[model samples]
Target: MSNLPTPAEIIAKANAELNQAYRALGDARDWLLSDWDVQPTAEQAATIRRMREAIGTAKDAINEGRP
Candidate 1:
């Protein structure tokens, strides 16, 4: 029979996912910041910054194994 993952293993998986999410969010922000014919509005830029911050918060929680 296959052994189930322990709590530590589960947290590790969640942390990996959170790290990926953070990276993806950062990539999006970078793309937004890149030069383009049309640029994001002030509000749009602010929203992207907020989204990145939220992703950072999630990464922190996952590292801490918060419920």
Candidate 2:
């Protein structure tokens, strides 16, 4: 018998991967914001804000479009 994954299994795997990516982004965000004793410089703060927005956009896309 064939052992190939079914469509549902493939989709489940993809969703799991996407969740992992989202988690990694969160971890990076936490590290950038809290892992250091010193505050980020203005440029660094701006970049972090951009990164946060991007993560929020990704979350919205995942919530709105995921199967």
Candidate 3:
């Protein structure tokens, strides 16, 4: 009990983690595009954009009720 986080604290931590993961994914994608010379086709670009958007949306959904 002493070591347990409150519900709000747990939600805050989870949201922070999710945001970090999303940023990491975006950074990886940027590195591939800029440093690794990625050349995605139109469809591939769309797919990547959608995936990024989905990651953000999921994070928002998860953090909806927390402070």
Q: Assess candidate 3 and give its TM-score to the true structure.
A: 0.50
User: lDDT of model 1 at residue 61?
Assistant: 65
- Model 1 TM-score is 0.56
Residue 61 in candidate 3 has what lDDT? 67
- Two-way TM-score contest, 2 vs 3, winner: 2
Best model per lDDT: 2
The better-scoring model by lDDT among 2 and 3 is 2
Model 1, 1-67: lDDT tens per residue?
7599989999788778877776776687677567868778999889877877776776676557643
Q: Give the least accurate 10-residue stretch of model 3, judged by summed lDDT.
A: 28-37
Query: Which sections of candidate 1 miss by over 4 Å?
Result: 39-67
lDDT of each: 0.74, 0.81, 0.70
Q: Which residue pairs show backbone clashes in model 2?
A: none
Report how far off residue 31 is in candidate 1 (Å): 1.1
Which window of 10 residues has the lowest lDDT sum in candidate 1? 58-67
* Tens digits of lDDT, candidate 3, 1-67: 4988998898889878867776776676565456436678899789877877776676566557435
After superposition on all CA atoms, what RMSD does each candidate show versus the true structure?
3.6, 2.0, 4.0
Q: In model 2, what is the error at residue 32, expressed in angstroms?
A: 2.9
lDDT of 2 by residue, 1-67 (tens): 8899999999999888888877887787676667667878999889989988887888777767567
TM-score between candidate 2 and the true structure: 0.73
